[model samples]
Target: MPTLAHQQIHPHPHNKSAFAKHVILLLSTMMAGVLQASSATDQHYPIDVQSCDRIVTFDHAPKATVSNDVNLTEMMLALKLQDSMVGFTGVSGWKTLDPTLRNGIGELPELSPKYPSKEVLLGADADFYFAGWNYGMRVGGGVTPDTLDPLGIKVYELTESCIHIMDKPKVSMNDLYNDLLNLGRIFNVESRANTLVTGYKKELADFQAHLTPLPSPTKVFVYDSGEEQPFTSGRYGMPTALIEAAGGKNITDDVKKSWTQIGWESVIDRAPDVIIIVNYGDVTAQQKINFLRSNPAFSDIPAVKNNQFTVLEYVEATPGPRNIEAIKHLAKAFRAAL
Candidate 1:
C-alpha cells in the first residue's frame, strides 16, 4: 500500500500538471514584459546604441558644388542655395520643374555626359563633389572621389543614395535629415537646418495622422530605374514606404531584396490601380507613356487603360527633403484615380 501523501497525489496527478503549466505561462509573460521594456528603452535611446563606426562627424562645413544628380540638386533648391552650384551634367528635366522656381536658372550647361568627363569636371574647379548616385566613378569615363581627392576636393556622397560597400549606413528619412543637418552645421547654418528638420517632421506627422483607411487597399505598381529588366523598390527601399504611406499596396512588397526585377505577366495578372513612372537623365514622361502604349504586353494594364499615371521628376522623387512633396503628389494622384 502507498503512503497517504502518495495516494492523495496519485488521485489528482492532472491537477499538479495543470499547476505546472500555469507557472510556465506566468514566467513566459514576465519575460515578454521585460523584452518589451528593453525594446522601448532602445527606441528611446537609439543614438547611444548605434555603433561608433556608423557615425561620421564633420568639424566644419564644406563648400560643396554638386555634380549633376537628382536628390542633391533638389536639396540645394529646397535650401535655396542654387548660387553654390558651379558645374553640373545631365540637363534633360530642367524644363519639367516649376517654371516660377526655375526662372533665373537659365539654360543649364551639360557640363558632362551621363558621367562628367575628367576634363570637364576638373575645369569646374569645385571645392567638393556632391553626387546623387555612385555611378560617377566609372573607370575612364568620369571623375570619382578617388580621382578628385588628389586635386584637393573632398567628396560627400548623399547618404540616402549610398548603396555601395564603402558608402554610409542604409538609407532612411533620419539619414537624409541628418545629412541636411550636417550640411547646415558645415555651412554654419545649424539654426536654419534645425528649423527645416522641425518643419519636415511636422509635415510627416500630419500626413501620418490623416491617412485614409482603405475599404480595399488598391494595388500599386512602381516602375523604378530600369525598363529592360524592371527594377522595383522592394521591402527596404523608399518606394515601399511611399506606397504604404499613400494607402496603396506595393505589388513587389513580397520581394525581400532592396530592389528586384519581376515579370511583366505577373504585373498584368495583379492589375495594379496606379502606375508610377520614374524618369532620370534624358528619359521623359512622354517617352515612358509611348513605350507603355507601344508595348503589346503592357497596353492592356488597368492603370494604362484608365490613364491613371503619375510621373515624378528626377529630383523630386529622389529620397530627400523633397520626398514629402513626392508623397503628397502620390496621395493626391491615388485619390484622384480612385
Candidate 2:
C-alpha cells in the first residue's frame, strides 16, 4: 500500500494475476476473523477488490492509445485490436506500422519524447494508459499512473518490462509469447492471440530447421549501450540467444546476469570475430563505431581490423515479438561475413 511511484514503475511490465488471486484468497480467509470483530462496513474492503489493486479498475475497459513506444502498440495491433487505440506518442515516423494502423497512430497526439504536462496527458481523456516502462513517468517530474489514478484513469505496464512478475521466469521469446497471450485475454482476443503465436512458432521452427550446424563457430562480442565502461548482456540475457541463433559464440557467455560491467582486457583476450552495438534514442550507430575505432584498446582487435561491426535498433534487441526478425537479421549479417 505504499504510494511510491517508482517502486511500481519498473523497467518491464509484469503479470501477477495467478499469484495475486491465490494470495488474496488466502489473506481474505485469514482476515475474516478480524473483520468479524469489527463493524459490518469494514468487511466490505476485501469483497470489492479487483485483480490488480495497485491501480484502480474501470467498470468498462476504455478506448486507449499507448504513448511510450512501439513494441507494446504493435503487439496490440497483432491482436487485431488496433482500433481500440485512440492516440499514441513519439511514433509519427514509424514505418513498420500497418497502413491502417499508421493512420490511426498518426492521428493520435504525441505525449512522449518528453513526458507531457499533467494537463496534456489528462486532456486526452484516456480511460487506459499503456506504457513501455516507467522512466517516462516518475515522481516530481511528470504525471505518472498515480497522477491519473486519482482522476480514475488506469495504466497497464507492458508485461515484458515487468522485471518482478514476468510470466516467463526470464526475458526471452517465451516471455514475449506469454505477454501476447495475456494481452489477448485482456482485450478479449484469445483466438487471434493463439493464431499469431502458432504462426510465429511455426515460422521459427522452420527457420531453425534450415540452419546448418555451426562447423566452426567463432567467438563474437556484443558491445551494447555503453561507450566508456561498455554495458553488455551476459550469458543469461537475450543477447546470448541472438549470438547463438546467428551461429556465433558469445564471448560473454561465461558471465552471469542480464547486464554487467566488463573490462577492456576481456575483449582483448577473447578476440571476437564480430562486434555489435545497439543504437537508441540519442546515440547513433556511427557514434559507437567512431568511439571504438578511436579507443586505444579495441583498435587492434581482429574484429576492428576486418570492420566486422554491425548496429541494430534498440527496440529490435528487446525481448518481444520482433525478436525472431532480429535474430534472422543478425544471422544474415554473420553468415555474410563467412
Candidate 3:
C-alpha cells in the first residue's frame, strides 16, 4: 500500500538491482551509438582535396557542378555524378562528341561551346567547377579560380593538365587514377571510385604481363593537331605515359613540353616507329593520316613508311577512362609494326 511516488523512487528490494542494471545497459547502448555516429560524420565531411598546388576544402558535396572538356567531363560522368551537374563547357568548340560521350552527357545543355566566362557559371548557379589549366581555365582567364571563387564556386584541376600552371612530376597513368579518386572523394563517391581504380590497375597489369620483351622500345609519336607545325604530345603528356605503358617510347620524350608545336624536323630526326593520331576537331583522323602519307617530309619516317599509323580518339589520348583500351590498341599496333 506504499504511495506510487515511493515505489517509483525505490522499487521492491529484489527488483531494484534488476531495474538499475537495465537502466545502465540502456544508457551505455545510447552513448555507444552516439559515439559511432560522430566518428562516421567526422570521416566524411569537410574533405580536403589537392587541386594543383592548392588545397581546397569542402564541407559538403556540391549540389550544382559544371565540368569542362570532354576528358574532364567524362571523368565526372565515370563517377556517375551527372545528376549533380548543371551543365558542361569546352566541347564542340574544338572537339566533337562521339556517340558514347554524347549519350553519357544525356540532355545536359552545353553551357558553352568553348571556355565559358565567370558570368556563365554564376548564371547556372554552379557550386563546383571541374577543369584544368587551359583545358577550361586559362592563366589569367575570366573563368579562373580567382575569378570564380569570389562567386562561391570551387574548382578542381585535372592532374595531367596541372603541368601548364605548376611544376609536376613526370606524367603517368597514376595521374588518371588520382583524378578519379579525388573526384570520388569530393562528390562523396569514394567507394565507387576506389573500385573502378582497382579494376583499372589490375587490367593494365594483366595486359602488360602478356607483353613480350622487345629488343628495343618502339619509337612513337602522338599527333594531336596543327597544320602549320603539328601539335604533338611530349614528355609530360598523358599519351607519353600511355606510350611507355604500351612498351613503346615517345619520340618526343626529350622535347621538354607536354603538348606543343614541335618542328616537323624534330619528329623527323627522332624517326618514330609508330604514329598515334588523335582523332578530334575539324579535321578527320583519315585526313591527318593522309597528310602524313602524302607528305614527302614524312615519307622516310618508319611509321609512315610501314603505314603504322594508329588512330585514337581525343578522349583516348588524354587522361580519361579510355586510357587502358587505348594502351591495349597501341601495344598491339606496336608489335604488329615490329
Candidate 4:
C-alpha cells in the first residue's frame, strides 16, 4: 500500500488537472454552503406592520430613527434593534430600566429629557418614530403620524397609550405581547419576540401556580400622582391588568377611563388593601408615600394604615416586556402582605 504522501507525489499525469478541478469544485461547494447559512441568519426585511389602525411597511429594518419615552426605547433595546435608533428622548425613567437595558441605552444619544421638538426630530432625519400618544408625542405637537408620515417617517404608537385614541379601551397581557411581536416583525426579529413572550408566559404560569388562592382578590390602588385629586389606573390601563395578574383587584376597575384623576374621597371610600406607587419624573415614590402618610384623609385607608405599598416604575406600569417582572413583584408583595 502506497503512503498518502507518495500517492499525491506519484499521481498519474493525465489525472493531475482532473484532481485539481475536483478539489476546486469541492472547495466552492463548501464555501457556497457557508454563504447560504450566513444569509439565512440575516433578518428578513420589507415587513408590514399594522398597529393602531395604521399600516406601515418597512422596506428594511430602520437604520436611523428617534424613539421617545421609556416604553418605546426599552422595547427597541429588548428586541436588540438599538442600532436602528439614531437618538431618543425621555430619560427620566432610565433609572428604572433593567441593568442590561440601562447599559444598552447608556451609549445611545438622548435628544431630550422629555419629548423632542418637531424640528429636532426632523433634523435627525429619522426614518421612523417609536412613540406614544400623550406619553411621548402629543397631538398638535407637530410630530404626529399624520405630520411625520408625509415626511417619510413612520410612527408606531405604544399599545398602552392607544387607549386614548381607540374607540374601545381595555388592557391585557396580549397588548404587550402584540407590541413586542409587531416590533419584532418590523425589525425582522420574530424569533426573539417569540422567545421573549414564551419566557414571560412560563414565568407567569409558575408564579400563578405557587400562589395561594384567596377567598377574594386583594384590593389594590395605583397611585401615580396628584395631591388634590389622586391619579389612578382604571380598567383600560396596563397597571389594572398587571394588578389583576398579580391576584389583586384594582379598586378603580369600574372606571372605564385609563389614567383618571379621581377625588380623594372616592379612594377613601374603596380603601384599597395595597397601594402601588408609580415611580417617575421629579416626583419620587417617597414623595407619594409622604403625601399619603401626611394626608389625614388617607389615614383610615387599609393600605396607608398597614403601609402595604409596592413601588413600580412608570415604565413597568406601561404595556411592555417589563410588565411580567412588574406582575411578579406585585404578586410577591401581595403574598407577603397577606
Q: 330 in model 3: Cα distance from truth in Å?
A: 0.4
lDDT of 4 by residue, 1-338 (tens): 98875776455888999888888998999999999866754546566787677787787777787888777777887888877889888765444444665787767777777777777777888888888877677767777888888788888887777767775557888888888888888777789999988888898989889878766789999999988888888988999889999899999999988788988888899999999999977789999999999988899999999999999987789877688899989988887777
**Tens digits of per-residue lDDT for model 3, 1-338:** 99865776656888988989988998999999999977876789998999999999999889999999998988988899999999999999998777898899899989999998988998999999999887898887788878888899999999988888888988999999999999999988899999999999999999999888777999998998877799998888999999999999998888767889988988898899999999988899999999999999899998999999999989899889999999999999999998
Question: Poorest 10 consecutive residues of model 1 by lDDT?
Answer: 45-54
The models' CA-based lDDT, in order, is: 0.63, 0.64, 0.91, 0.83
lDDT of 2 by residue, 1-338 (tens): 77664455323235567667766898998798667655443332222111222433334435664545655566666676667776665443432333544654555555654445556556777666666343244434456666777776667655444542222344456656766775655555558889999998888888878976666775788887576577887765666777776678788887765557798789888888788887665557788888888887787787887788877666666555677887787777676666
What global local distance difference test value does model 2 have? Answer: 0.64
Q: After superposition, how far is residue 148 of candidate 4 from its true place, in Å?
A: 0.4
Per-residue lDDT for 231 in model 4?
87
Candidate 1: Cα lDDT at 143: 69
Off by over 4 Å in 1: 1-59, 93-101, 104-110, 138-142, 166-171, 224-228, 235-237, 254-262, 279-287, 293-296, 299-301
Number of the top-ranking candidate, with lDDT as the measure: 3
